[model samples]
Target: MELNQRKGKVMIEQTLEDALSEVYLQISPNILESFPKFRPPVDLYIYDQAVAQVKKFHRAEARLGTEKQAVVATFARENLLFLLRDDYRVYAEHLSRKLGLVLVEDDFKAREVSEIFFIAFRDRMDVFLSQPKIEPFKELLRDVSILAEYLWTDPCRVEFLTKTLHKEYDLSVHSVNTMFIGLGLFVMASGARPERMEVVNLALGLILHDLGMTNVPKFITDKTQYLVWRDRGSIENHINAGLKKLERLEINDPTVRQCMSQHHERLDGSGYPEGLRADSMSMAGRLCAVADSFSAIIGDRPYHSSKVFNEAAGTLIADKGRYEPALTRLLVGLLKEGFPGCVGEDMN
Candidate 1:
């Protein structure tokens, strides 16, 4: 009878998990605001490992009353928790508050909040890749604006953002990393506050700099052997391909075009497509170049093993004239202060 009861409990738990998966979203309790003037209509659930079941901590209306303290404390103490997916806007607002507070308190909860942001950003990017539509791209631009504002205010959130980078090598993940790291480097190096529009434009450019790579044949990208001129030519053509696609999308921003066109170009005129020298390259182009190179180097590829952050930063710095000296130094500084050391290995 005890064995039967155990089996029945397991089945019930599985059913609960499945049912909740549809209506609820798992959330880190760290971002929950202990008190808010406006609490959204949403139920909160905490999974009790002792009983192996999820239990409602508080109903939607209860959160508006004095029971709020209890709800926050209980959720913060629990390991597994869920919130109504319908109330995501409330959660986003809560995250915004937490992000601002974490910076003031010199707290680590920034990682928790930013990790959620990163996941959502990556999901949006995935949709854009599959659809490649104007709406999705516009939504991505909105995210870029938020990120730029975040960095513009603190500039140090780059450290927390780095911790959230998905070590897995994919176009979406790489693009996101480049955007975050590039914007961080740009903000850090600029000293004086940058215009909001400049930051947004650069952010968008960094994220889409490799958009052309989607047009290349997978076999060429995945090739393990030496590439002939034809193969190299095909790979290098991604710039034009990405630019053409953007043009079709009606994206006429010169900053965006510069990033897509010049990220591969070296300061010493050793790059492809256009062999533009240092004097000809824009700062946005240089910023994207360093960011693209660093993000790619630290991530594993079909052709090469991933380099550690220190090694990758050193490699870029060692290249001397290939990359801009000031930007490489900024990259090094960012790594020294922010890099968590382990990457592409244990990062899940």
Candidate 2:
């Protein structure tokens, strides 16, 4: 029975890998080069990052205890790779309501080759985060997953991306840049402790703390006029807008809560609707505030030209009481070093 169980696991692993290899091979370098915005599914990325061998990811999963093992299984079932179907008729009939992914008649699926098609999700999690309570948090995880995939293989690009990010200030672009900046700066701020959870949670919170913006009208976000009292009120309301979005979700993670509620606040009792001071603002909030302002300064806006890395760093430093001093120091040092010359995780 043990042997059979092992064989079953291996079979599932091999079958999934075989399908992915076919997809990867079918999407040749030429094909991939054609789509400049193309990003691999998370499964393929994790597999690639774990080791060249297909067996390694499964082994990592297999080694997990029961609780974590179940989580992996849940992830697999809800993964985008598993959701793509030529017909997906049953899915269209049943799952279209529950899922928020791309679904169409096989012919309409991909704008590219009909023979080889793909479908991903703005929110791919069909089951794992389907609960009313679990769904709000999924966007944070989804964005973080995309950022991780981009970082896991192309660490050099992560360092260089801030320059490009300065030219565009879309919400998603800003969030991605913030995740990388905050993760890197937080490591420098904390003296580079090896505790993985600190960086992970910080990355997630920084990326999604602006979730409330999705509800705010684009006109307000894009306005050319100086923000009046009502406009500022609308902007400040986003903090609670974000909190309300996550209120149904049963998140035990305090970082998520702090980021959702406090990203706009300052240390000098001068920020936003609440006017929270240094004592009230949590460490996560303070660190994220620095990253948020840094990215915003570097990012382009209708009102002002984008600042270079040094100029952006100076803006953060000059705003003394608004941000934590030690974090600002680390951030300045990080900008000077240009992120340790693009240090990266080894595949080994």
Candidate 3:
């Protein structure tokens, strides 16, 4: 009877999970493993799983009042990972006692995961990395946008966003890192009062920039053989392929489409598919290009190991006609401050 009852409970949970998925358009497979990353955050596990991980978090937070805070406290208490911001590095005695959640600040480092996720993200890509296809991670982004939004404000988020971009790097990690970087650049470059929607779009665009790479066969992505120029040419088709794939979803924003399409186009007319020159590129395109290049070179990959920041910076600057000279320099500058948000302000 006990066994039957346990089975009944498991069955009920599975059914609920399925029903919740159908109701929410923004879905993620790592819902259970990740935190309640949505804005203002959510209280209950059910709401966190169904709403917090989706666009609905913004809506749900409005209707939820005091209970939401209590629930957030509960969720934070349950998940012990600390996300202390600089201001909160040392907590007051009273506040620490009152708040059950941990608030780690100042000192945290990269760690690995069995999957592409961690309770907190890290920069260490040695044996700690996971190489999954692009599709799953892209799908997971919607669920984690809230988390990504709040990462800059906390230490874990900063650590997660600063991870290296290797050849076999996890798609989700690289996308989120690029999103933060590109968004950071936009926020700084756009002005003291940049448009909020622009920040959102740039983040979304960078995260999904390489989404089409999932279409590439694993054999090719994992190809151990040295390829001739022709084989390499076919491999580079991911950018155009992504544009077409995203088009099928009927994405309404041209900015995102344009950003993705032109991310690889060189300023010197040396880039792929449609070799656009520097004069032809928009500020957004240039930002994404620099961000993508920086992210790609700083991580370890199956094809090649990660490059040091100085080495990568030198390469970008020296590679004439490949990247915007000024933007390349800014990317290098970003590394100095641990690549935090509000970089543009500092640059200015």
Q: Against the unseen true structure, what C-alpha lDDT does each candidate score?
A: 0.72, 0.53, 0.50
Residues 1-348 of candidate 3: C-alpha lDDT, one tens digit per residue:
012222211233556545543432111112212333443222233233322232222232344455664544443343311222221212222122222122222122221110132222222211122433345434443433433444434323333344433334666566656665666555445434444455556666776777667666666766667976766676678887777766765555766776788888898898866889988887778888888887777666677788886687778888887887877776666566544443221110
Cα RMSD for candidates in order: 11.4, 13.7, 15.5
Q: Please say which candidate is ahead in TM-score: 1 or 2.
A: 1
Q: Candidate 3 at residue 149, lDDT?
A: 40
Off by over 4 Å in 3: 1-168, 224-226, 338-348
Candidate 1 backbone collisions, by pair: none
Where is model 2 poorest over a 10-residue stretch in terms of lDDT? 111-120
Best by TM-score: 1
How much lDDT does candidate 3 score? 0.50
Q: Candidate 2: where are CA atoms >4 Å away?
A: 1-166, 339-348
Distance from true location, Cα of 148 in model 3, Å: 8.0
Q: Is candidate 1 or candidate 3 better by TM-score?
A: 1
Tens-place lDDT per residue, model 2, 195-284, is 445545666677767777777778888888898888778888888877776674545478977876777789998886588999999999
Stretches of candidate 1 off by over 4 Å are: 1-108, 338-348
lDDT of 1 by residue, 1-348 (tens): 012222322344667766665556554445554335345346776656557656776676553555765655555544355676556545654554333433333222345546656765677778887777899997887767776666667555556676566667888889888887887687677765677788888888988999999888989988999999999999999999999989988998999999999999999999978999999998888888999999999878898888888798899999989999998887787767643332321222
